[model samples]
Target: MQAVWKLSKYIKPYILFAIIAPVMMVIEVSMDLLQPTILQHIIDDGIAQTDTSYIVKMFGLMIATSVIGLIGGIGCSIYASRTAVNFSTDLRQDLYETITYFSNSSKDKFTLGKLVTNLTSDMEMLQRALTMLLKVFVRGPMMFIGAIVIVFITARELFPILLVVVPILAFCMYYFTALSGKLFHKVQKVVDMVNTKVQENLAGIRVIKAYNRKNHQIEQFTEVNTQLMKRSMAADQIIGVLAPLTMFVVNLGIVAALWMGAIKVDNNTLQVGVILAFINYLMMVMQGLMSSSMVLVQLARAIPSAGRIVEVLEENTDLTSPLKPEIKQIQGSISFENVSFSYLKETESVLKNISFHVNAGETVGIIGMTGSGKSTLVKMIPRLFDPDSGSVKIDGVPIGSYSLEHLRQSIGFSPQKATLFSKTIADNLRYGKSDATSEDIVQALQSANAKEFVDKLDAGTEHLLTQGATNLSGGQKQRLAMARSFIRKPSILILDDVTSAVDSISEKTIQRAIEEQFSDATKVIVSSKISSIRHADQILVMDDGKIAAQGTHEQLLQESILYQEMAKTQAEKGVTLSE
Candidate 1:
C-alpha cells in the first residue's frame, strides 16, 4: 500500500481519467438497471393494458439509453487503457534512474538476475495491476452498489436476504485475500531463485563444459525448476478453491431470492415483473463481486513486486561527492597515511596501517604474492572506497574532500582483468578521455604496444569488439585495456598486472614505451612476477595485508629476507634479472 502511495506522482496526471472512468461506469450501470424497468412497463402498462402506443414509446427510450451507455463504456475503456500504459512507462523510467544511482557497494547487494527481474517481470506485474485497477476497480463497485439500489426499489422485504449473502461473500473474499497474499509472496521469491540460477548457468557455461559437469548443471537447474513449480501450484490451488467458493455463494443467493420471490407473488404482495427485475439485479451484484475478488488476487501478486522495486529506489548511496567543494588541479603526488581499509566493519582490514608517498615523475612498484591486497591498496587513491581508518591524499588534499568526478579524473586505472565492451576500438579508447583526438589515440596505442595489431585489422580503429571481446586473445585484450588507460594522460596511473599474459619480449617493449611516453607521470605497478617491477625506483614488498619491506629493488633484496628469497626463486626459474 505504501508502494502504491509512492507511485502517486506518476499517476497524478491520470486522476481525471480515474474519476471519469468510474462516473461513466456508474452511468452504464444505471442504464442497465433501466432495462428491467422498461420491461416492467411493457408488461404492466403497455402490453397488459393493450396500449400499442405506450409500448412503442417505452421501447424507443430503452434503445436510446442502451446506445448512450455503449458509447460511454467504450470511451471510458479507451481512456483508462491509455492512462495505465503511460503510468507503467513512467514507472519503468524512474526505476531505471534509481538503478543508475546505485554505488558499487550497493550493486553488490543485488545480483544481475535479480535486477533484471525487477526491471522486467516485476514491472510487468505492476503494469497488469494498473490495467486491472482502471477496468475492474471502478466497474466492480459501481455495478454492485447500483444493483443493490435497484433491488431495494423493487422490494424492501427482499433486502434482508442481501444482508446475509453480502456479508458472507465479503468474509469469504477477505479470507481468500489473506491466503493468496502469502502464497504470492512465496511465488515471487521462487521466481528470483529461478532467475539467479539461469543467469549463473549461462555465464558459467564454459566452466561447466570444461569440467564435464553438464549433468550436474542440469540437475541443479531441475531442482530450482521443481521449487518454482511447487510454489506456483500452491498459489494456483488457493485461487482454484476461491473461484468455486465464490460461485457456490452466488448460486445460493440466487436460490434464496427465487424461493422468497415465489412466496411474495403467491401472497399477492409482489408482481411477476418486479420479481424478474430483482433476479436480474441479483445477477449483476454477483458479477460485480466476482470481478472485485479477481482484482484482489492481482493486487496480492503485484504488492510484493512493488515492494521490491521500492526497496531499490529507496536505498542510500554509500559513495557520494562532497556537497560543495573547491576543484583543484592534480600534480601526480600521492600519499597514504596510516591507511587501513575493510570491506565490512566487522571484518579484518584488507590493508593494515599502510603508509607511503610517491612524488611526481616517480615510478613506484608493488610486488606481492596472490591475495596480498595490492589492488585494494591502490584503489583507495582514486577514492573507489573510503578507508575504514586513516586517509589517502593527492596533491595536499584528502581524496574524500574532492568531488568524486574530479578525483577520479586525475587518475587512470587498468584492472587485473582486461575488459572490453561491444564497441569499436576507437570507441573503447575514447572512454578514457571522451574528447581525445585521433592522434591521441594512436600515441596511446603505441605506448601500450598495441599499434601493430590495430594496423593489421581491416577496419583498424573502427573494428568492433563483440561482447566481452571474445574474439581477441588474452594478450591483445590486455594491450587494448592498457591503451584505453594511456589515452587519459592522467597525472597518476595504476596498472594492475596488465602484462601478465604477454611474452617477455612484448612485456619489455611495453615497459620501455611506458618509461618513454609517460616519464613525467607517477605510476603504481602491481605484479606478482619479480621481473616486472625490478626496475622501479621504489619497490614495496607486501605479505598478507601488510608491507613487509619498502625500498629500491636492490636495497630491498639486500635488506629484506622475503625480497631476497623471491628474487632467488625467479632467477632459478630462468627469469632474467637484467636492468
Candidate 2:
C-alpha cells in the first residue's frame, strides 16, 4: 500500500483528469441522492392530494435529475480512464528505460519472464485499480454518508437498524480483505511462474522438439498453470462470499425497517410516502457498501502489484557513470591488473587474480576449456561487469574513469550467442551504427564472410528475420552478428567464439578477412579451436579462472602442457591449421 503511494507522482501529470473525475462523480452521486426526496413529493403531496398537475411536475424533476446524473457518470468514467491509462503508459515507459540501462549484474537478478510479467500483467493490475479508485472509491463513501444523513432526517426511529447492520458489514469487509490480501499476493506470484514457464518453453521450443521432450514440457507447463488456477480460485472465492454476505445483512435491515414502519402506519404515526422514500435510501446504502467492498478488494490486489513494480523502480542501479567522468583519447591499449570477479559474494571467482596486457592494434587469442572464464575476462574490458578487485585500464587510464556510454561505444563486442530481433537485415545491421550506409553494410558483410550467402537471398539486406532469426542457420546468424560489430569499426573488437558454428574453411576465410579489414584495430578472439588462433600475436591458455600460460602459439605448444595436450588431441583427430 505504501509502495503504491510512492507512485503518486505519475498521477501528478494527469492531475487535471484526476481532479475532474471525482468532481464529476460527486455531481452524479448528489443527483442520485435527490431522487428519493423527489419521489416522496410525488407520492405524499401530489398523489395524496389527488392533484394530477403536481404529480406530473415532480415526475419531470425526477427525469431531469436522472439525465444529469447520467452525464456526470459518463464524464467521470471518461476522465478516470484517461488518468489510469496515461499513468500506466508513463510508468511502463520509465520502467523499460530503466531496464535498458541496467548493468549485466543487475539484470542477472531478474529472469526474462519475470521482467516481462512486471511490464505487462503487473502493470495492468495497477491501471485497473487506479481507475476503480477514482470512480467507485469516491462514489461509495459519498453514497454511504449521503444515505445515512437522509435516513436520519426522514426516519430517525428506523436509523438504529443501520447501526447494527453497518457494523456487521464493516467487520465482514475487514476480515475478508485481510484474508484475501495474502491470497491475492500468492495468486500474482503464481501468475509470474506461469508466464515464466511459457516464456522458457517458447524460447526453447526447438531444443525441446530436438530432445523429444514435448510431453515433459507439457507436464511442466500444466503443473505451473494448475498452481495459478488454484491460487486465483482461492482469491476469487473469498471475494465472491463478500457480496452475498453484504446483501444478506442489508436486506435483513430493510426487512426490519419495513416491519417497524408497518406498525407505525397502523398507528398512523408515519405516512406511506415517508416509509417508501426511507426504503429507497436504504437500498442506496446497500449499493454504497457493495461499492466500498469492491474498492477494498481492488486495493488488496493492487498492493502486491505496486510493491513488485516499486521493487524494480527503486532498485539502485548498481552501476552508473560517475558525476565527473574523465574522458580521454582512446587508442585501444588494454590492461588487466590482478583482476578477480565473482557473480556472487560467496561463490568462487569466475576470473581469479589475472594480469594481462594487449598493445594497440595487437591480436590476442584466448583459448580455454568450457567454464574456464574466457567470456568473463573479455566482458570486463567493456565494463559490462566491473571486477570485484583490481582495475581494467584502456589507453593507460582506468576504464571506470570513462563514461560507460563512451567506453562501450569505442568497443565492438560479438557475444558467444548471437541475439537478433524480428526486423529486416538492414535494420538489425544498422543497430551497430544507426546511420550505416549500404556500402558500409556490404563491406562489413564481406569482412564477416556473410556477403556471399546474403547476396544469394531474394531480399538481400531487406530480408525480414523471424524472431531470434530462427529462419537462418546458426553459422549464418553468427556471421550477421559479427558483421554488425564490424560495421561499428570500433577501436577495440572482442569476438567471443564467433566462429564456433562455422566450417573450417569459412572460419579461416573470416580470420583472414578480419586481418584485412581491421588491420589497425585491437582484436581479442576467444575460441576453443587452436586453429582459430594459430596466427595470433599472443595466445593465453586459461585453466580454471587463471591464465595458465601466455605466449605465441608455437611458444605455448612447447612450454604449456595444457596447450600441448589440446594441440596433440586436435592433431590426432585430423584437425589441422592447413585444413
Candidate 3:
C-alpha cells in the first residue's frame, strides 16, 4: 500500500485535472441526490392535488437535473482519463530511465520477463487504479453521504436503520477487500511465471523443436497456465461475492424501511411521496456502496502490481559517478590495482587481486579457460561494473571519476553475444557513430572481413536486418558487431571472442586488420584460442580468478605451464604461434 501511494508523485503533475474530476463528480452526485426530491414534489404536490401545470414544471426540472448530471459525469470522465493517461506516460518513461541507470548487477536482479511484465501489464493496472481512485472513491462516499442527508430531511427516524445497515456493509467490504488482496498478490506472481515461460519458449523455440521437446514444453506451459487460472479464479470468485452480498444487505435495509414506513403511513404520520423518496435514497446509497466495493477489489489487485513496479523504481543503481568528476582525455593507457570483483558482492570474487597495466597503443591478449573471468576483466575498462575492492584507472585517473557516457563512449566494446535491432545494415554499423557515411561503414565492414556478406546482399549497406539479425549467421553477426565498434574510432577497443564463430581464414584476416589498421588504439582481445592472440605484444593467461601469467607469447610459453599447454594443444591442431 505504501508503494502504491508512492505512485502519487506521478499524479502531482496532473493535479489540476485530478482536482477538477472529483469536483465534477461532486456536482454529478448532488444532481442525483436532488432528483428524487424533485420526483417527490411532482408526486405529492402536483399529482395529489391534480395540478397538471405543477406536474409539468416539476417534471421539467427533473429532466434538467438529469441532463446536468449527465454533463458533469462526462466532464469527470474526461479529466480522469487525461490525468490517468499522462500519469502513466510519465511513469513509463521514468521507469525506463531508471532501468537504464541500473547497475549491471541490478539489471540482472530483475530479469527480462519480469521487467516486461512490469512495464506492460503492471503499468496498465496502475493506470486503471488511478482512474478508479479519482472516480469511485469520490462518488461513492459523496453519494452515500448526500443520500443520507436528503433522506433525513423527510424521514429522520430512518437514521437508526442506517446505523445498523452501514456498519454491516462496511465490515463486509473490509473483510472481502482484505481477502482479495492476499489472493491477488499470488495472482500477479502466477502471471509473472506464465510470462517467464512464454519468453523462455519464444526465445528457445528452435532449441525445443530441435530436441523434439514441443510436447514437453507444452506440458510445462500448461502447468504454469493452470496455476494462473486457479489463482485468478480464486481471486475473482472472492470479488464476485461482493455484489450479491451488497444486494442482500441493501434489500434488508429496504425491507426494514418499508415495514416502518407502512406503519407510519397507516397512522398518517408520513406522506406516500416521502416514503418513496426515502426508499429511492436507500437504493442510491446501496448503488454507490456496490460501486465502491467493486473499486476496492480492483484497488486490491493493483496494490501488488504497484509494489512490483516500485521495486524497480526504487532500485539502487550500485554504480555511481564521483561527486566532483574529472574529465581526462583518454589515450588508452589502463591500469588495474589489486582489483577484485563479483557480480554479487556476497559471492566469491570473480576476479581476484588482479593487477595489470597497458600503455597507449599496446595490444593485450587475455586467454583463459571458461569461467576464468576474461570477459569480466575487460568489462571493468568500460565501467560496466565497478570493482569490489580496488581501483581501475584510465590514463592515471580513476574510471569512476568520469561520467558513464563519456567513459563508455571512449571505449569500443564487442560483446560475446551480438545484438542487432531491426534496422538497415548501415544503421546498425553507424550505431556508435551516427554521422558515419557509407564509405566509413564499408571500410569498417572490410576491416572486420564482413563486407563480403554485405556486398552479396541486394541492397548492400541498405539491406534491412531482421530483429536480432535472425537472417544473419552467427559469424556474420559477430563481424557486423565488430564493424559497429570499429566505426566508433574509440581510444580503447575491447573484442571479447568476436571471431569465435568465423572460419580460420576470416579469423586470420580480422586479426591482421587489428594489427595493421587498429594499431593506434589500445586493443584488448579476449579469446580461448591461443593462435588468435599468440603474436600480441603481451599475453595474459588467467587461471581460477587470478592472472597466472603475463608476458610476450614466447615468454609465457617458456615460463608458464598453462600457456605451454594452451600453445601445445593449438599447435598440434595445425594452429601455430605465428604464420
Candidate 4:
C-alpha cells in the first residue's frame, strides 16, 4: 500500500478527472444522506397528518433528489474510468520505455515472462484499484460520517449502538485486510510463475513437439497453474469472510436499534418517524463500512503490483551514454586492450586478457569451437554487454566516450540467431535504413546472395513473413539478416556465423559480395568453417577465452600449430585449402 501511494504522482496529469470523480461522489452521497431525513418528514408531517398534497410534494422532492444523485453517480463513474485508463496508459508507456533502455546485462536480471506480467497483469491491478479508490474512497467516509452526525442529532440514544458496531466492524476490517494482503502477494507470485511456464511452452512449442516433451510441458504448466488457483482461493476466502462478518454485525446493530426504538415509541418519548430515519442512517453507516473494506482489499492487491512496477521504474541501468560524448565520428577501427569479462563475477571470465586491433578496411576472421567466447567478443563493439574490466575502443576513443546511439548507428551487427519480425520482406530489409529505396534493398539482398530466391516469390520484396520468419528456410533467414545489416552501409559490420545455414556455393558468393561491396568497412566475421574465413586479411584462432594465434591464412599455416591443425582437419573433411 505504501508503494501504491508512491505512484500517486502519475495521477497528476489526470488531476482534473480525479478531482471531478470524488466531487461527484460527494454530491451522490450527500443526496443519499438527505433521503432518510426527507423520508422522516414525509412520514411525520404528511402521512401521519393525513395531508395527501404534502405526501405528494415530499415524494416528488424525493424523486428529484434521486435523479440528481443518479446524475452525480454517473458522472463519478465516467470520470473515474477516464482517470484510471489514462493513468495506466501513461504509466505503462513509461515502464515499457524504461525496459527498452535496459542493457543486455540488466535484462538478464528479469525473465521475459516476469517482464510481460509486470507490463500487463500488474499494471491492470493498479488501474482497477485506482478507479475504486477514486470513487469508493470518497463515498464511504462521507456516508459514514454524515449518517453518524445525523443519528447523533435526531436519535442520540441509538448512537451508543453505533459505538459498539463501528468499532467491531473496524477491527474485523483491519484484521482481514492485513491477513489478505500477505495472501494476495503470494497469489501474485504464483501468477508470475504460471505466466512464465506458459511463455516458455509457447516460445519453444516447436522444440517441445520435436522432442516429444509435450506431456512434460503440460504437467509443468498444470503444477504451476494449480498453485495459482490455490493461492487465489485462499486470498478470496479471507476477503469473502470480511463481507459476511460486516453484514452480520450491521444486522445485529439494526436489531438492537429496533428493540430500543419500539420501547421509546411505546413510551411516547421518541417519534416513530425519527426511529425509522435512525435505522436508515444506521444502514447507511453499514454501507460505508462495506465500501471502506472493499477499498482496503483493493489496495492490498495493488500494493504488490505497485512495488513490482516501481522496481523496474527505479532501476538504474548499468549502461548509459556519457553525459558528454567525446567521439563524434567513427572510422571503423576497433581495439580491445587487456579486456576481461564474465557474465557473473563468481564465474570464470568469458574473455580473458583479450587484446586486438582491426584497422579500417580490413577483414578479420574469428574461428573458435563452441563456448569459446567468440560471440561475447564481437558484442562489446555495440556495447550490448560492457566488459567487466579493461577498455574497448572505436578508432582512438574509448567505446564509452561515444554516445550509445551514435556508436551503435556506425556499426551493423547480425547475430547468429537471425531474429526477423512478422513484417513484409521489404520492411525487414529496410529495418536498418528506414528510408532505403527499392534499388538499395535489391543491391543489399543481391550482395547477401538472397535476391535470387526473393525475386521468385509472386510478391517479391512485398512478401509478408510469419513471426520469426518461420515460413522461410534457415539459410534464407540468415541471408535476409545479412541484407538488413548491408542496407545500413555501416562503417563496421560484424557477422557471427551468418553463413552457417547457407550451402558452400552461397557462402562463397556472399563472402565475395561482402568483400566487393564494403571494401573499406572494417568487418569481423566469426565462423567455424575454415573455408568461410580462409581468405581474410587476418585470422584469429580462439582457444578457451584467449586468442591462440593471429595471422593471415598463409602465415598462420607456416607458423601456428592450431591454424595448421584446423586447416588440416578441414582438408580431411574435403574443404578446399586453395583459394
Off by over 4 Å in 3: 157-160
lDDT per residue (tens digit) for residues 367-484 in model 3: 9999999999999999887888999999999898898878888999999889888999999988879899878998899999999999999999999999889999999999999999
User: Residue 375 in candidate 2 has what lDDT?
Assistant: 97
TM-score of each: 0.88, 0.96, 0.94, 0.96
Give the TM-score comparing model 1 with the true structure, all chains together. 0.88
Backbone clashes, each candidate? 0, 0, 0, 0
Candidate 2 Cα deviation (angstroms), residue 456 = 3.0
**Candidate 2 total steric clashes:** 0
Query: For model 1, how does the per-residue alpha-carbon lDDT over 431-502 read when each residue is reduced to its tens digit?
Result: 999999999999999989899999999999999999889889999999999999999988898999999998
Writing each residue's lDDT as its tens digit, candidate 4 over 1-579 gives 567777889999999999999999999999999999999999989988999999999999999999999999999999999999999999999999999999776666777778898999999999999999999989988999999999998889788999999899889988998899899999999988988888889889999999999999999898998899899999999999988888899889989988998998899888778888988998899889789878888888898899999988888997899999976679899899998989998999999999999898899999987899999999999998888888998887999988888998898899999999999999998888999999999999999999999999899999999988988999999999999999999999999999889988998889888888899899999998888888888988888999999999888889989888888898899987665
1 or 3, greater by lDDT: 3
Predictions in order: lDDT: 0.85, 0.90, 0.89, 0.91
